[model samples]
Target: MGIESVLSEHRTFHPDQTFVDQANVSGMAHYEKLCVAANENYEQFWADLARELIVWKKPFTQTLNDSNAPFYKWFEDGELNVSYNCLDKHLNTQPNKVAIIFEADNGDVTKVTYKELYEKVCQFSNGLKTFNLDLGDRVVIYLPMGIEAVVAMLACARIGLTHSVVFGGFSAKSIQERIKDAQARLVITADIQFRGGKTLPLQAAVDEAFNLGGCESVIGTVVLKKSKDPIELDSKKIWWHDLIKNQSTKCDPVFVNAEHPLFLLYTSGSTGTPKGVQHSSAGYLLHAMNTMRWTFDIKENDVYWCTADVGWITGHTYVVYGPLAMGATQLIYEGIPTFPHAGRFWQMIEKHQVSIFYTAPTAIRSLIKASELNKESNP
Candidate 1:
């Protein structure tokens, strides 16, 4: 029997469950239409999309720029602060809307509203400014999947500070290399990260990395205290609350060049150091938001879950930037799939009634091996 038939013989999905097959559909066909339509009457399409999504301080005369090296600039010469479009504008329309729903391994959960998130982001952004981290300065983030990490990132973007987020699981050497390559002036990390059944010391890794020769010795390492285990706190390391506690929640967003590098994500290398995959601010946001719209079929009320760490481009594009731009509810999961059991994902899905789920293909293969899909009670 074929695998499908064999699987059907042993089990099957619930009749009510919808099977979505968008793979066979030409992904490029729609984009081709967009490109053609965009080219035919570039001004109209560009203006419509721009007016719909972005907040323009000054309207643009040009729709696109082909002279750039990276080659795509949407709404060129248009003035729009990325953070303003993503956070502030959303606050006016949907201030009370739930933006992030965090699900932890310990079954604890929290939801953050756009208004609340905006305040936190502003305070964090202001706090970073107090450290003299101006625009173009790099902030290396070594944070696990959580709201704070997202806040730190948005705060950086708001102020035009380039952020380089390292996955929480990478080794000290790897972290050091990225920090060095970016020459980050500030490092943000948590005291302890809880994943699966293990407690990882994130701050310790940051400390070890700081010892290496990349980031300047004068760099500030801000530690968020999430766990209590008498972890050594250095003089150079300041508590998150202490830094941002008295800071103002109101900060002006800085407008940057359309082609200016927004964030640098280092790709994992096989034999040598990772290559930093840089993305421009305006174009990247537009592409990311557009992809999120069609690829996931996002709805305003949909509870979206992207099972990828912030370290990867998948997380940056799908989890944070894409959903946030679309004003969709995103779930930040802070643990491994096998933690406790493979049932964890299903539990979240059933609990949240998640409308759209996006995970890596590797995860699907793992699920096939574990036969968890068959283990579903409906099967």
Candidate 2:
């Protein structure tokens, strides 16, 4: 089952003939020289990328200062806003480009262009201010994938709030633990999560976490309506639609120090205590942006898709930040792969014409197993 053994057995390979070969026309040979320079001077490599790849309000003079040992800082003296870097710079040319294509499990589809997304971010950011959220404040997002989930993250970035997005499938106690750890004052969630033809009460789960744990820091919960289920909202609960409806879409982006905490992500630990990890602003932003370009070969014309939920680090870095920073169109699905049929993933590729697709190995294996079963049945 080893990949090395399989390759040794075949002893055959073929180059990808259908590759568009854009690099051949665009300084492909010079890339090798750049690679050599990077290998020789990594500091200069990062510094050059920081300067050219992203916009900084106050550029850093120093590329890196590893004097602090394992905790190194890059572009330490710089100032920038993640929201501005991802949205503002692309407005002129890519205003109408589809930034996010959302497909629900129930066959409903929605698209948000760059211009519209920017406006929505601004509106929700202003709405966040209405909640009296200060800079560096923590906002816990418990919504499923869609425009609102995407907007919640960007809105927090726009206002310098630290958002912690809890995965939709987490248990009530798990959500309580993260909310308690972050001491987040605001909770953003949806009425329901639709997956595998089942309705999970995402907002109800948040309510249970709050009711049981009673985190005193929580001021109110913002709820997005994905289902028409009857619900009662206490004074502490707010409808996301109504909250942002009257808000203006003209909030200015907040610029913070390069090392300012962008967000906190909580992950399970074998020791049973969930660990909360924080990423710095400038370093993390540039890392995601540069890696998206060099690693994924993403371009303006390409349609990209990273099949991961925003609750995890992979989704946060690749699905949300990376493509957005590069102004690349991305497909976001709000369902499991085998929802309608086993061939759903392939159908999506044809439907979206996705050029660059990224997914987890578990999904790949699942597809392989399903295909083998199908072959056996047909044969």
Candidate 3:
């Protein structure tokens, strides 16, 4: 059997079926050749790909420049906001296009269109502006995968705020460490997360962290009311829907310097503490967008499924950054794969007809274990 068939045994959707219809290139060996060729002729490769995928405000005269200390600068002196390239240019052509498909633990699904996503992102950006959070300020987002999480991250990117998204499963102590390290002025979170048939008290954890006073320096906190039961808040907390929806959807994108700090993604330190890895906007976008286009071979009609949580760079890059930049239809699920059954992810694939499934090795192993359990039980 081929690799696609092997993947289909675990895949929620069938391969061969037109999941993703278009791409600039494909194949492992082909990608190896492309990468080797690009490294050999780096300038031409980046220049050609940028011209093909992105709408540049100022066409680049030079592609790769690494003179900046510890910084990789691509298309330096280019004057386009990364968010602008991702959203505005595509709006005219695919305004009504599906951008994000959200699947929750309770079997509920919601689709947000590009136009709707653009408006929501703008509103969230304006909401941040209302807090006087501007370029270079840090925002911490600890929310589940859904339209709001995606919008919040992009909104921070839109106005040049360096956002650090903490995984939903992280402990309060872990959350405090990131918030304190980023010196975040603002925080966005949901009251509770429904997963594995249990109510995860995310708000309570936030409250505990705040009580520890590690994040006392934060200027404001925003809460999204996902559940009906009201979650308590301090004088510092504000309602997300109340703060964002009223804002204008026409905020101009903030064009940042090429070497500006785009974000700080924390990884596990050898000593056990998480160390934040800083990334630059231009080069990071170039790498992420190029990978998305090639890896998924996504087209206009493709319903892409990136089965990773938003907390990891995988989700941040593939699920939000990569797919949205290309204007591909994306499916995001918020729960454990076995919450209802091992087949939950596959069910989503069948239901959404997902293409381009991306997930972690941990999950693959889990599914394999689940298959073993099913066989043992059935026998």
Candidate 4:
């Protein structure tokens, strides 16, 4: 049986210290009533959630259609843009609020406000249009966890292009497979990927993938320079900064239907070929908003950190889409906990005052061991 099948254990974790004095913290009774209402009328529940959480260009007429049992269509007639919901909605109320706190592996830090993010997304969107690609064109993004990575994905969404993000650490064979599968005409990758005391030549891997992986559809490669050292450029390679420096930052967002594909992410299929999983734009946005608000108790003032690479779904959902859609600021650290020192993660929490943090169990075990070893070695 699949997990998450039994979400409710007839109890709640509401009214925590974060909301003890607020009227919104009416205790478990409120959640119980909601649960009962949702269970009794799922259609109305979903419709209400979408209406409240999502920013729609055109209101939806239908909530769901499960006629095709295996595949269900939701918010069938709604029109929206994921990028707009994430950055644009917060422009009026909190333009200066930090949307992303990017800390590189080398201890370099940068903050992107909502207004800044919106402009950058628009600029990148215009830059992407320079390729003369039409709506629904695919762009494969093989980038590390950085502000630029977020901007790239949002740019694709803003222009109605579907982006397939391959993990930065993925091998050339993997990148080639995903790019070929998506038939992407453009590829965006970084010059290098830094992890602790190591560096991976990411663009080299992308180039190798193109040579070895049947990339006849690829027109050009957009390279992001994470390192200060200038990388040699070729006819096929375009500097990411050069493309955006003179571009217009006032591009309009293309409104897509709710069921339109937002992004195509791959799953590591141990036995067979990795399969691309497609996510709908509005459905995904709403799910992320509701999940973060209820599960993590994400607040407007909270600073969240999910220790997962941007390539993975955890980071894609929490670090990029979910928190941003909720108008919440989050930390995007492009390094591991064991990097520099075992206490790096703790130091970051204190430095940024992170309220909620999520990580894999494996990371927890490794951190514990590293902490003990560091204490022994230092003492």
Candidate 5:
């Protein structure tokens, strides 16, 4: 039997004419036109988008390579740096534009402009060079949702090192498995994470993972000090501030092949062993950019917010890559929805004037429940 619908509604809400006029996709006719164009010549369609959206070190001759069957490649002949596409390109146009708006759980706010972010990425990239990490070397990032996490990921991409960002909430055992699987050369994490009025030890987990053994590939750990209290450090540990202090903010971008592995993200291992999924440079960026523009109707002045951790795929695409690639300002929150108050998210949306908001359905449901509770209590 066919699956039956649990709920149905005939009501429909259309967008205001003002919004439709300014939207990227606009109306159904425009979308259908694009669909037709793409369906008519799919390879050329992707090629056109790749050329328009990406700044390539070397232009691609072929769009897709399917000679290998199940394992296919895209824009294999081209070369480009993911970091450059995200930050450097934006500098010429909107250097002073706010790239990241960080909202801490305690209600503090910090903003970083494009030029500032570029310099930080460059400095961190140079600092990573001091560690003697070479091309294709994997670095694992374990940090909270903040600017440093973005900087670390971009820095790794800038220097041609593959980065795997593990969610900050993952246990030490999970961290150990990812580190071993990725064979990470270095691990970057903060001293602590403040979330929902709780101080969680991030660095301690990395250390615990090391103590668990089997992470021999990792050479050192870069710790971003988030806590006020002093923490013990060994020769293998280095403070992030110290590493980038004296470094030059002029690290050159290392352009890699289109098919070069940009980063590795692992599955939750719900069914079996967690498998690492590798994403390439050009194709992934292209898709992310396109989706950001189409789905969010992203604009230059819009403050976009994706309420997802940087460790997840949504965060990787929307919070970090997609928005930046489009030169759109984004907001990153370092707290849960119900922290401090149930209306925290709504307050932020109004405070930041976020034009586009992307979140999971579970988050919406929680907000609804919170609203109901608040009303009952007030009544």
Candidate 6:
């Protein structure tokens, strides 16, 4: 017999009138109009967005290439850089605009502006070049969620390198498998990760992954110094600060074909082996930008917050690429929602003046449980 459902949800909550009035998609009519436009001419719909949103070195002639079924291509002939769309284009208008507002596990906050972020990304991009990596080369980023993680991803994107970001929470075996599969030539990670009011070893995991074999393609490891504790550095180890210290903060963006890969994010491998999912430059940016605008109704001055690790796809699309592509300010927290106290996330939202928040159902459920427990204890 089929399993019977024990839970049901029939509640429907409408948006506040204030929100509806100011949203990018003001009402159902506006949303339907967008859907109808796309449904009428799907390719042209995307093509128009690509041209309007992205600054291309060479504009695309063809929108969708489906000559080979199931192995489709998009904006195949265009030339553009993903990092430029996210960072460089925003420099002239809002260089001083806050791009990332990072909240540390200990409740410390650091704000990075667009111009500062651009310079740092360029410096790191130049540092990566010193390793003699060729275009389209794969780099494995195993860093925790922070400004450096975003920098590493953008630096790779700036120079036409494809990055595969492994979750910091993954085991060494998982990291080894992904490194082997990507044939990554370089690995970027922090010496330690701060989370849940505790410091955890991160570089050690990379070391163990390398020692497990099959990571021969990796030539070096760039370690970001986070902890005061001393750690052993080998020949293959390069300090992230040292690598970029002598480099110029002006690495030009490497424009590649629109179909060129931007990043490779792996699946959880819950059922089987983890698979690397590749996203192309033009199409992915177009989707991320549109969705950020449509779903979040992101405004210029609004401070957005998405509680997801960079290792996951949601973080990739929303936390880093999507918000940056839209030139929206975002908050990045480097700890669990319940760290230090049950009211951590709530306090942060108010402290940062976050206008929009996005998170997973699991996080919401956990927060609810925390609230219930807190009420019982206090009462």
State which candidate has the highest lDDT: 5
lDDT of 6 by residue, 1-379 (tens): 9999976998999999998998999998998998999999999889988898899999999999999989999999999999999999999999999999999999899999999999999999999999999999999999988999999999999999999999999999999999999999999999999889888988999999988999999999999999887777899999998999989989999999999999999999999999999999898998999899887889998999999999999999999999998999999999998898778989999999999999898988888999999999999
Please give each candidate's TM-score: 0.86, 0.93, 0.89, 0.93, 0.98, 0.97
**What lDDT tens digits, residue by residue, belong to model 3 across residues 77-169?**
765577776788778899988888888889888988888888899988888898887688888898977888988888888899988988898
lDDT of 2: 0.89
RMSD of each: 5.1, 2.7, 4.6, 3.6, 1.2, 1.4
**Collision pairs in model 5:** none
By how many angstroms RMSD does model 3 differ from the true structure?
4.6
Query: Between candidates 1 and 5, which one is better according to lDDT?
Result: 5
Identify the leading candidate in terms of TM-score: 5
lDDT, candidate 1, equals 0.82
Off by over 4 Å in 4: 1-26, 375-379
Model 4 — TM-score against the truth? 0.93
> How close to the true structure is residue 53 of candidate 2, measured as C-alpha lDDT?
86
lDDT of candidate model 4 versus the reference: 0.89
What lDDT score goes with residue 243 in model 6?
95
- Sort the predicted structures by TM-score, highest score first: 5, 6, 4, 2, 3, 1
lDDT (CA) per prediction: 0.82, 0.89, 0.81, 0.89, 0.95, 0.94
TM-score of decoy 2: 0.93
For the record, the alpha-carbon RMSD of candidate 5 to the native fold, in angstroms, is: 1.2
> Candidate 3: where are CA atoms >4 Å away?
1-23, 26-36, 68-70
Tens digits of per-residue lDDT for model 4, 79-169: 9999999988998999999998988898888998999999999999899989999888889999988899999999999989999988887
Candidate 2 Cα deviation (angstroms), residue 109: 1.6
Off by over 4 Å in 5: 1-5, 8-10
Candidate 3 accuracy as TM-score: 0.89
Clashing pairs in 3: none
